[model samples]
Target: MYESGEVAIPLKDRVFGRYLADDVKTTEGKVIMKNGEYISHEEIETIEKENITSVRIKSPITCGCVNGICAKAYGRDLAKGEPVNTGEAVGIIAAQSIGEPGTQLTMRTFHVGGVASSSAEKSNFESPSDGKIKIQNLRSVVNQAGSEIIINRTTELEIYDLNKKLVSTFRAPYGSTLLVKDKAEVKLNDLLLEWDPYTVPIVAEEIWHFRF
Candidate 1:
């Protein structure tokens, strides 16, 4: 989901720089303003804080540039007395959604790593905390791998709400077909069956029950 927020501009620290002149070779770029037209980086120290305006935040994507220098570069131009274009001042919030199975798995693994690292950082030889941390780390590792094992063993699956209830389930037999909503139809193979709702418990014994 996309959300909008506001970012308060700091007037005192505005400094701008121009894009490399050699990079703008296209005819369309000829009309665009070049560097040195606005405030220089050194002039940022002179501006007062009250001169700032509210900037809109449309998306929450991570900036690849070092220390958000891209934003700072543009802010400097605004401060240095350049005319503003409608979209020119607005930042593109490139939100990324992790929808694919592989990406989801990777995120889960990353979360587990974080937990394991925290557990290790507090480890002490004499304290029982070390043993507890080891147990927690082991559990996270099993939980991560258990999902794949469940998917491999089960033909169908479903996810329920907060209450322990069955929302939906799919059944798989040899050559049986499963249709995902508006996506694709997949045929069941000997290895495993397809499922719905896609939120089944990742327990070894429970998964064993689904294995054919």
Candidate 2:
């Protein structure tokens, strides 16, 4: 029997039959108490958990049309004597505010830690003694591990695979020594040695989730 007055009800004072004057919009809009909705203890607990200030109770719908001023629009029917429903549900807005950014966070690229790189030497005519390993495609294995400086002077280039067995494997020098350290971040070409054969590992695969 809520009429048409705006009043605030304390959380503790809320009992059965009291309509939540405000729409409990968080995950979704929860209308705890409508014009004739029965309030339950669970609803009260929800209000407390959500930390809503107070509840809006119904008041007497006093008609002020005597002065030729219709309190409401001509065709608009008042519910329980109150104006057209003013309760608003903004749960969607709340959802998008958080959800949209969260989606971007997932799709967007981020630097992941604990990422080490592996590689196989590109096949070419260059020899290690000359400080140049002939890699068929320098861009492929070169970027995997940072640029290399060959001190081994061995014609056989040692390439290692840091990743596990999946399907494709570029056999440069299998079971070779690893050049890149665990969890490294590098920008622009850095000279580790004067005559490094490989290129800097600029693009790394740290997050395994994104690899597949």
Q: For this target, which candidate reaches the highest lDDT against the unseen true structure?
A: 2
Off by over 4 Å in 1: 1-39, 54-107, 111-212
**Candidate 2 residues 1-212, lDDT tens each?**
11011122445554433443335544456654454333456766776787665555442233234432232222112234323333322334447678866876898954444523344333232211212222222222232345432322221322222332222212222212334332232222321122212543233324234554
Residue ranges of candidate 2 with Cα displaced over 4 Å: 1-9, 14-16, 27-35, 61-212
Residue-level lDDT for 81 in candidate 2: 33
For each candidate in the order shown, give its overall lDDT on alpha carbons: 0.29, 0.35
Instruction: Write down the worst ten-residue block by lDDT for model 2.
Output: 125-134
Per-residue lDDT of 8-77 in model 1, one digit per residue for the tens?
Answer: 2343332233222222122333422233234444433322222322122211242345543344234323
Assess candidate 1 and give its lDDT: 0.29
Top candidate (TM-score): 2
